[model samples]
Target: MMHVLYWSGRAGSLAPLCLLIECGVPHETVQVDTSRHAHKTADYLRDVHPLGTVPALRLPDGQVILESGAMVLHLAELAPSLAPAAGSADRAMFLNWVAYGAGSLYPAYQRVYHTDHIVPDEAARPAAREAAVVALDRCWDVVEAALEAGRPGLFGDRPGAADVYLAMLALWHPAPERLAAACPKVRAMKDAVWALPSMRQALAVHGLETA
Candidate 1:
């Protein structure tokens, strides 16, 4: 059994908990609230992670693992049934999608968050919001097409790392209404992935279960 150090309500940490649920292993979720700045303490820095980010998984051997990308992928590997098998091309594709979500999509989402929610200047809100909306639209376009491309749920058989990550993105995205209107395929993917039992448990706990 593994123990996970996490902040359940946080955007980044939520998917990791979803991964844990999908993994179907006996693990414990140690709540770390970022809103209260609990992850910034020295004890957590030394004990949980140097960066003190939530969603760090503690190994049974006492090793602490950090970073959202690495955490989910590691859990995916450990719970191979949750993710895809690391055999050949499918493995590489899975990694690509996973990395793409963390790297490109996350950055793009950050821009949207900064422009939409975090920014304080009311005068510049429209321009910034438009810019962020454009970035988000571009990102979703790719995802929408990918969801429509040949495979239904990130892959043929089941939802893999890509599907899971993308589903969370769709769930946490700022402009879900716009996405539903613009990218029905991605909306379809979101519906399919969230329908999984793992996603249900994770999202349901946080009141994110609604369509």
Candidate 2:
């Protein structure tokens, strides 16, 4: 069984929770309420995730994994059904897309939604947010093109951990209208991923109906 440190309604927490359900892994959820800034406390930063991020997973062997994408990759290795085999033909693309979503696109959404954290100056937030919107839309376009080329799923005929990561980011990004207009394929992909029973259950836990 894995143990996940989570906070409700946070996008980062969604990946680990959904992966656990998809893998049929028995897990315990330790809620770190961000509403009260519990995640920012020194105890949390030191004892849990050093960067104070939620969705850190404690493995059965006393190893704690940070980064939602890293957790998904590890879980995929454990449960091969969740992703392609490491050396498989599709594995390289899968890995690339996962890293792109986490390292590139996800931060763009962060800049849009958490502008205050990105720039302390209130006056500068507008420009930052506008720039993020452009970057985010471009990111969506890239993913959409990739999905269109790889149809049925992100990598081939079936969804993988990378698609799950994409879905999470697509849902969290602030410009849904822009996303729909710019990345119809990705929007459709997200719909398919969310329709899965595992993802449905995960979203329901946070009272989310759709994304």
Backbone-clash count (model 1): 0
Per-residue lDDT of model 1, residues 1-211, tens digit only: 5665456574576677777777777778777767888889998898887986666878777887776877778788777666666687877878888888888888887877666566678898878877877887898888777665445477766676667777777776777888899988888777777777887888776666465
Across 1-211, the per-residue lDDT of candidate 2 in tens digits comes to 4555455576487877888888887787777788888888998888777888777888877678888888888878777877777787779888988899888887787888888997989998899889988888887888877777436567656667788888888887676877777787887788778888988888888778876
Candidate 1 TM-score over all chains jointly: 0.86
lDDT score, candidate 1, position 97: 81
Instruction: Give all candidate RMSDs, comma-separated.
Output: 2.7, 1.9
lDDT of each: 0.75, 0.79
Candidate 1 regions off by >4 Å? 115-126, 149-151
- Show how many residue pairs clash in every candidate, following the order shown: 0, 0
| Model 2: ten consecutive residues of lowest lDDT | 1-10
Off by over 4 Å in 2: none
Error of 2 at 147 (Å): 1.0
Best by TM-score: 2
